[model samples]
Every structure is written in C-alpha cells, then in structure tokens.
Target: MLRPGSTTAPSTPLIAPLAAPRTARPRRPGLKAAALAGLLALPLLLPATSRAQETTAADASQPTAPAADAGGGETRTEVAEAKTAEARAAIAAAQEEDANDPLEGMNRAIFWFNEGVDTVLLRPAAKVYRTVVPDFAQTGIRNVLWNLRSPLTLANKLLQGDWDGASVATERFLINSTIGLGGLIDVAGDHGLTYEYESFDQTLAVWGVPEGFYLVLPFLGSSTLRDAVGFGVEAYGDPVSRYLSNTHDDWASYTRAGVYAVDLRAQYLDVLDDMKRNSVDYYATMRSLYRQRQNNYIRNGKVDPDQFPSIPDYDSK
Candidate 1:
C-alpha cells in the first residue's frame, strides 16, 4: 500500500495471500514508531493548515490587483480628458481673440505706449484728483460733463432711429441745465428721466457698420477702426468743438479734454488697479474687457449679467 502524503508508487506484490488461511501476526516495531512520530507532528501540521486557510480568506476579501489597476487607469483617463477639454476651450478663445485683433502687433505696441502714459501722467493725476476732490463735488463735475455731452447724445440717438431716447436726452438736458443748476444735480434722474449716453460710434454700430480690427489709440485707449472714424466725425460735428474751433480757443479745448480724461480715470482708479494686479496678461485682459464693454454699450446694457465690471456704465442711472 502507498503511504499517505508520499509521492512514491507502491511495489507490486510477488505473490498473492491465500484467502482460506490467514495467519495472525504481531504488529511490527517500525509501525509503532511511525504512529508515534505522526502524533508528535499533529500540532505543527494543524497550525500550518490554519495559517494557509487564513491566507486564502485574506486574498478573497480584497479586490483583485488587475481590477484595482483598471479603476485607477479609468480615473486618470477622466482627468486627462478634462484637462484636454479645458485646453481646447482656451485655444478656441485665443483663436477668436486673434481673429478679432488682426492688427495685434501694432495694437500691442500702441497699447504699451498708452499704458506708459497712463502710469506716469494720467494715473498720478487721477489719484491726486480722487484724494483732493470731495465725493459730492466729483459727482457734480461728472454730471456737468455728462450734461454738456447731452446734445451729442441726442443727435446720435436720433441718427440711430431712437426717437424716444432722443426725447429723453432732450428733456433731461433742458430740465438739468435750468432747474438742476447746469446739471450739478440729477433732478431729471429723480423724476424718472434717467440719463442714457449715446455716441456717434454707437450710432454707427446700430446702423450696421461692422467694427473693424481692434485698436489701441495713442492716448484715448481701446477703440475699433469704425469707432475711431466715428470719433473723428463726432469731434468735427460737435457744437463745443466747432465753437471752440471758430473762436480759436484751442486752450479751452485742451483743458476740457484733460479734465474729462482725469475724471474718467479717477472713477476707475481702484477698478483698473485691481484688474492689473490680478491679470496674467494685462494687454489681453484689457482687449477682452474693451470688446465686452463695447458690446454691452451697443446692446444698451442687455448683455449677459455675468460680464460686468469690465467698464462702468455711469450712464445707466
């Protein structure tokens, strides 16, 4: 017979035992020794068996290594896809910006020149004005300036076929110029005739003139080709400009222009500073903001609410 747990084959029996006469023989001493040895090893074998069973249970309780690897790979793939999508969106936005700004090289050069002027001259003057001028006085000055531009606004409104806007502008101008002490106070605004600023550029936009390549003017800042031409037209046609030209009072025109620039810059001191501090590319940021602001103006504040703060719409009373 083969021994238990042994790999060796049993030897063939030379002769068969007789079935009729079976001899009763004593157990061998070797058999007794083997049985004793088996008893002695039983405790060690039991512990080993128990440890093997525990190992099998632990392996069964956990996820397979291949499955864990697959799950990790899926998560990484999702993250990669998300990053790719974001990159694509950024690329598309950059392309659109490039399309709008075909004159980017020249525009950027002018933009830097304007920035230098603003930083050295305009910004300091604006800071001083903001510091020295009282809030009420600043408001009055702004109102006066806006009121002075009312005629231009009216003309542009009429040109754009906005009769109601034209009427409102006329009423506001007449009411403020007289009762409001030359528009020092917003009397018409209190009476529900809120001011709405209109410009020749805006009229041109309403008239279906496309805004040609973005521009950064010498000292006036952001504009488009159409707007720049419209500005020239407005300047030539302006009553104040024409009167000043006729009277040969160039000094008065220069003074008025200076004050207007200072007041406009003063109003946006904190806003521009914050934008510059937070922006990665200040030029690109300004370009985007300028376009958005122009669009908002053209739409008469009917733009997406999410795109505010690029430029303040003081005319939206």
Candidate 2:
C-alpha cells in the first residue's frame, strides 16, 4: 500500500504564493544531461517486467478448457478477444482526443521536467525530512492544515448544490479540526470525535468535470485541464501562501516547496500506472479522467465510484 504522507492532505497546505514562481528549477551544468540519462535509463530497469509480460501472454495463449466444452469455448474466446479489441479502440480514441489538444502536449513537457527536478533533488530532501521529523507529527501537522481548509471546500460544494457533500465535508472538517486540536488549536481522540478523510481528487469529482484526458506534466503527472486549474486556484487560497507572503522569508518558501513536492509525488505514484494502462493516448486519458473528476466534484462534491479507472492488470502481477 502507498504510505500515508502521500496524499495525506487534499492539496498542498502550502500555497503557491509562499513559493517561488512556477519555473523549471535551474540545474547545474551537465546536470541536465545526467537527468536525461536517468530518464532514459528508467525503462531499462523494466527488462524483468517485460519478460514477465511475455510469460503471461504465453500462458494466456494456452488456455485451459473443460473436456466437454472445447468447441463452445473457442467461440467464447473469440468473442472475448473481440470485446478486448473494442475496448482497446475506445481507449485509443480517447488518447487521440488528448493528443489533438495543444495544451496537453505542453503540459506533458512540463510534467517531465518537474519530475526530473523532483527525482534528482526534492525527493532526496523529502526522505531526509521524513527521517528527521517524527512521522506521526508530520502527518498530524498535515491533517491539521487540511481541517482548517475544509470550510472553503464546504462552501464550494454548497454553492454547487451538493448538500450531501457539503454536509460530509463540514462534518469531517469539524471533527478533524476540533479533535485534531483548533486543527493545532483542538486533538482528535482526546476530544472524542472521529472521521475519515477524503482525497483531493475525490473532491474534484464532486465538482462536476470530465475524465480521461491524460497529461504528463513536468512537475505534475497525468492530470486533466480541470485538475491543473483546480490546483492553481487552491494554491491561491491556501493559508501557507498568505503566511509566506507576509513573512517574505526565502527559506520558508523553500521549505514549503519541498513539502509540497513530496506530498504531490506520493499521491501521483498511486495512480500513475492506472493512467497509462487505461488509455492508449496518455494525454487523452489524463484529460478524460481529470475532466470527469472535476465534473463529479462540481455536481456532487464526490467522484462517482465507477468513474475511477482501474489499474491495468500488470503482467508482472
């Protein structure tokens, strides 16, 4: 299972204004080449993954059948194959839509560059942060922040007429913030309140958006246009952004960026393969998924269960 620190919060509690402008992190001379090399080498590590896939295909080709049903089974297999082909075609059509959109291509480039910067620099720092800080404390800090912001999410849901979602958001926020301690100002079990958290992605679904447009962003991955915009808007409203702007401390900004990157990386890792597997056109898949999620969030303040794409069956599995 993916660890909690990842997606522990809906959005980065730290806002964009608290950090430097969204530009590529400048790399040292020759570092770019090294980053490129690392990117290229990533696929090389998947030889065993590929071999396993081959074995699975071979096994699948030699299907087992009950002795009495051989002829009928052949027909069934053909029908199944046809359905699989149709599914593949549908996925491809979705991908084509994403590819045709000019914005997605640009997003993809940005996503990779961001990934390179994070993998090389930010991720290492995050590992250290985790080591130096108590895990429980950090997670607690994150949850506290999320609680404080839940009201804003609640209001948005209410405006959208998603009363059920607004109620749930309000309840979770109140329970977590009060018990989580005024979110730092109230503690949970101590106050005798308990609630489960929802994901940022899920929140988008409640808002009503499209899904299946796949985008590989430089720092972000596999996002739709709606999600990208939502991230930006959320950043604008974050308290951390307000705090950092008032303080004007460069170090504070950097610290916030580091934490934000770590949180984002962890969340994306969970659904990375699902995005790739569900659509032949990575761009369209992201767009579709993101759009669907946003529409869901707007209309009901929650993603419909069926809208979440399943992770493709991994041959290695």
Candidate 3:
C-alpha cells in the first residue's frame, strides 16, 4: 500500500515507441532498436501500474472502515440522549410529588382556629400570671405546683390497674398540693383528690372506659373523643374553678376559662408551631403526633419530645 502522503511509487514503468515498420531487409536491427526503446520506457510505465495496484489493494482491504466508525458514533450519541431524557423525567416526577400533598386544607383550618383561641383567651391569662407572680421566682413555684398535681393524676390513672398504689399516690398529691401550699388552693384536691386522687377520669378508666377514636380539636389540642368530654367535666372540678367562684366571685366563669386557656396555650406552643411548619396536612399531622404521644404514654407513661419530629421554628436550630 502507498503511504498516506506519498503521491508516487518508487518504480515508474516505461512505454515503448512503435517499432519501425517491419521491412523485408534488415528487420533484426529495427527489432533490436524497438526492444531497447521498450526496455528504457518500462521503468516509467511500471511505476504507474504499481501505484494503481497498491491503491486498489488498500481500498479492497478496508471496505467497511468508515461505516463501522460512523455507526459506533451514532450509538454513543443515542445513549447519551436517552440518559439525559431519563434524568429530566425523574426530576419532573419528584417535583410533582412534592406539589401534591393532601392535608393542606385541614391543616389551615386547624391553624386559624388555634390562632384565634390564642389571641382571644390565652394571652390575657398569661399576662395575669405575669402580673400576680413575683418575676421569675413565681413561675418556678407554679411549675412545681403543676408538676406535683401531675403525679397525683398519673398515680390515679395508674391505680385503676394497681388500685392500692393509686390510693397512696393520691393521698401524697393531695397532702402536698393542698396543705403543702397552705390552703390558698388545694389545686390537686379540687381535681378530686380525696385522701388519694379521685376523679371521673380515673373513675371511667376504672370502669373500663375504652379510649375512643382520636380526634384533633384545633385550639384545644389533642384528645380522644371520649377524653375530650372527660377533660370538660374535669375542668369544672378544678380547684381554680372553686377559687374563682368563692374568692373573685363575680364573672367567675369567664375568669376560669381564661386561666384554662392560658395553661393550655403554654403547654402546646412548641409542638403546635412545629406542626404548622413541617406538616402539609395539618389535621393528619396533629393526629399523627397525638397518636404518637399517646402510644409513648401507654408504653412509658410520659411524654418524650424525642419521639416526635421537631416543631417548626423561625431559626430551626
């Protein structure tokens, strides 16, 4: 084969001129001259034929070279295009999934209701707490009082299963909350602590009240259908209810409701804010969170924030 840049071969074939007309006399001399001429011209002519042969041979050896390379390039291009299309489709699906959450409307309703209750009833009560109490010191005392009351209720609840322990704990809670605080208000006793804690809530559980279906009550926070009613009844039995009636004695109903609203608001502020931010379905979010809390309570008899997702916050830290 010829090298890529070379235009000519080394041997060039020569052409012979026509021999002098064959004559009868002295034809040998003429033949010899013709042979000599043919020999001399053969070099130039041979080179041309050799080059043509080399070109033909090279062409014959690689008939499919260009076609094979072209086909491979096309295949590579098609694969790249397909991969790009697939990636775009995946991104579109993800965006669509994010856009279509089902619980948005319910969540909005709950959010607005909670906001209204907070503004109208709860904030004012907190202000009263601020005014009556001595700075940071009173809040700590109030917290302790609140905590002492919780154990009594918790013991009362546990006692339905282990009645004896409930009886003992109730006595402890009553003695501590009422006498310990010096007759101002036996808050724990108002909830129905006899010598021990006793209440309709504990009574119902003792009588085997099945926990009804869980329901989200927007401003009121989490409760089962049955427990919600239980809460209402229990609220009337509160020590503060008696205090408001006997001491303040004027618009006692309104004052008691305001206090209840304040306490409720303070308890749920962090978790409620979280649901507003993280959940697309506000009702479902609340339901799920409440259920989760209940399950933990059943298991360990306490609320642990670790089990729940963090509520949304401005800083989100």
- Candidate 1 Cα deviation (angstroms), residue 216: 0.8
Encode model 3's per-residue lDDT on 139-239: one tens digit a residue: 44544445434554654556467666566565655565556563234444455653333444444645778556554467676566566766777666556
Each prediction's whole-model lDDT (CA): 0.87, 0.60, 0.59
Per-model TM against the reference: 0.72, 0.48, 0.43
Question: Cα deviation of 22 in candidate 1 (Å)?
Answer: 38
Best-matching candidate per lDDT: 1
Q: After superposition, how far is residue 298 of candidate 2 from its true place, in Å?
A: 6.8
Per-residue lDDT value at 123 in model 3? 61
TM-score of 1: 0.72
The model with the greatest TM-score is 1
Model 1 Cα displacement at 102 (Å)? 2.1
> In model 1, what are the clashing residue pairs, if there are any?
none
Q: Give me the overall lDDT of model 2.
A: 0.60
Off by over 4 Å in 2: 1-91, 94-105, 163-179, 182-218, 243-254, 263-317
lDDT of 2 by residue, 136-207 (tens): 767665665566567666756665566776777776666665555656533443544333333344455555
Error of 2 at 303 (Å): 7.1
lDDT of 3: 0.59
